[model samples]
Target: MPYTGPQSVDRALEMLDAVADAGGPVSAKALARRLECSLSTAYHLLAPLTERGYLVRTAQGYALGPRIPGLQRSLMQHLEPVPRMADVLAGLRRATGAEAYYTAYRGGLITVVDTTAPVTDTGNPFTPGRETRAHATAHGKALLAELPRPVLRRYLAEHGMPRLTRATITCAEVLEAELSRVRGQGFAVSVGEVDPAYTCLAVALPRGREGGRGRDGGAVHALSVSLPTGEFRRRPQEIRAALAQAAAGCG
Candidate 1:
C-alpha cells in the first residue's frame, strides 16, 4: 500500500479489544499497561469511543456504553430479528398509530438505542445518544426491575429522588412498591413520568454474548416503546408484547 495506517489507531483498537474482553471496565493505567503505552495515549484512544457513545465510565472502571446495543439494534432493525426478526414493530406501529422507541440501560441511565416514529407523527426533536433519567423512564424501570434489592436501595439512597412530573415516583417507599410490581411483571410502564404528554413501556432484554452496559455503568439493556398518553392508553399491551419480541431478537 502507498500509505500506512496510523500506529496510534492500531494501538487504540488493541486497547478497546482488551477492555471489552475483560467483561468490565478497566482503569486508564491498567489499559495503558495492556497496550504497552502511556496512560495519556490510552485516554486519547478512549476519548473517541466515549464521544461515540461506545464506552462509559464507572465507579470501578471504564466499560462498554449502552450505545453498542443501539448499533446492533440499527443493524437488526431492517434485517430479520434473530431468525432475522422482521416487521413486528411495523405491525405494532400500525396497531397503535404513534411513535415508538427501543431503549436499554447503560451508565446508570437509559439510552435510546433506536427509535421509530410515524410518518404522520408530530413529536419532539430528540435524537439518539441521549442519556435519560433511569427513574423516570420505563426502559430504566425494566432494567431496575432486575436490580438486586440492595443495589437498588443503595442507588436510590445515593441519587435521591427527583420528580420530573406529578406522576413521577419520587418517594422511596412508592418507588419500591412500583419496582416490586415491575419485577413481578417482568416489564415496566411509565405514565407521563419522563415527559408529561408521553408514556413509555419497557422490558429488559437478556444480555447477549457480551453482558452488561457498555464498558461503563454495568447495567443491562431494555426494550422500550413510547407513545402519546392518548395512544398508550388504548394499546398498552400491544406495545409490551411487541417490545418483548424485539428484546428476544436482540441477540
Candidate 2:
C-alpha cells in the first residue's frame, strides 16, 4: 500500500512531542539532532509552526504555544462542557424556533461540528462536514471576516467568490467591504444566499484568552441560528441579540 500518512503533520507532532518530553523549551539544534533532520529543515518547520501558534519561540528555544490546549479541548470527546454546549444549542433552538449550529473555521475550511435542529424541519440542509460556502453563509462570513488581510486575500484568490444566489457577494472589493461591516457590527448575516428561504445570523467567539485570535486573526469558532425568511424578517434584531448574548456566555 502507498504511504498514506501526512509526513509534515507527523513531523510537526513529533517535534511538539519531543518538546513536551523535555519538560521545557527545546532549541532548534536539539530538535534537528533528535529528529535526525537538517538544522535548516528544523528551522523551516519551526518558523511556520510558530507563526500558526502551534509552537512559540522563546528565549531558551521553541515551546508549545497556548493554542495547543484549545485544540486539545476540541478533540477530547469525553470533555465535560460538551453537555453544557448541547444545552446551550438546545436553548438557542427553542428561543428562536430555528436550528442552532456550532461551527469551527480552520485550515481554510468551515466544519459544522454540532447542531440542534427540530425534527419537524426536515428541509434543513446543513449538517456536520458540509462544504463551506464562504460567500453565502453567516458562519462562513463571520469567520472569514476575522481572517488577517494576507490570509483573507489568499483565500479569496484561491476560492473566487462563486455566487450561490443573487444576494451573494461576488467581488473581492465588495466582500471586503461586507466583512468590514461584519467586524464593525460584531456579527454576520446571510439572507437567502445559501438557501432561498433560510436566513442565518452568527457571532464569532474569541479563540482563547491566552491565544487571543489565531495567528491569522480569525475567530476559532462561530455560533449561528438558521430560520425561515418570514420568521427572520419578523425578528432579525431579536435573533441577533440572542446570538450575541449566547456568544458572550461562550466567551
Candidate 3:
C-alpha cells in the first residue's frame, strides 16, 4: 500500500510501541522484523530515539530509556485528579474491600487517572493509563453510557469493540443495549469482561468542567471498584453502596 501518512513519524512511534510491548530490551533486528521494515531503516529510527534518550542500547538489546520515566511522570501530573477524589477512592477501597479506580474520558480516550488497592494485593490489573477497551470495562461503559449517540458512534468507530474475554461485548448493537441498561440503572458492571477472575462495578460522576471535551462539551468522570469474581458476586449490593457513597463524597 502507498504510504500517504508521515511514514517516518508513524514508524518511529510504532517502534516505541513495539519496544514497550516487548517488556524488556529488544534487538534492532527483532524490531525491524516485527515492524516489517528494513534493518537499515530500523537503525535509522533507533539512532534518533537513542539520541533523544527515548531508547538506550544495552548489551542485551535496546531498552526503554531515562526519558520514559519523565514522560510518564509528566502524563501522571497532567492527569492527576483532585486531592479529594484520591481520598474518596482510598475510602472506597477500605469500605468495600476492593480495588478502587477513578477514571476520566477525555481526548477521545478513557484513562485511569488513579487507583487504590489493599496493601497486600499484588495482582491488580487496571493501572494509570489509557484504557483501549472501553466496551469491555465497567468504568469505560459508565462513561460511554453518558455520551450522546453520535459521539458514542464515533468512539466505537475509532476504537472498535475488541473481545478481551468471552464475556466482552464484541457486537456494537449488543454493547449499545448494555449501555442503555447502564443509563437506566445509573451504574455499569463488568462480569469478567476484562479479566475472567474479577468483576467490576462503576458509576459515572457528574460531568467535569475541564478536560474530557468531546463534541458534546464536558469531560466524563467515573468511579469503579473491582474484586474477585466470587467475592463480587457474594457482596454486589455492599460494593455498590460503597461505590455510590464514594461518588457522592467526590461531588
Q: Which candidate achieves the best lDDT against the true structure?
A: 3
Kindly report which residue stretches of model 2 are placed more than 4 angstroms away from their true locations once superposed.
1-83, 118-122, 209-212, 216-219
Tens digits of lDDT, candidate 1, 53-163: 788888878888888788776744432222322254455456556555555444344456555663334355323445546777787777767766666776677666788
lDDT minimum window of 10 residues, candidate 2: 209-218
TM-score of 1: 0.55
**Against the hidden reference, what TM-scores do the models get?**
0.55, 0.64, 0.80
Residue lDDT tens for model 2, 10-80: 77778877886676899999999998888887876677688888889999998888888888667534211
Worst ten-residue run, lDDT, model 3? 209-218
Span of ten consecutive residues with least summed lDDT in model 1: 77-86
Q: What is the lDDT of residue 148 in candidate 3?
A: 74
What C-alpha lDDT, on a 0 to 100 scale, does residue 18 get in candidate 2?
87
| Candidate 2 positional error at 144, Å | 0.8
Query: How far does residue 133 in candidate 1 sit from its true spot (Å)?
Result: 1.7
lDDT of each: 0.66, 0.77, 0.84
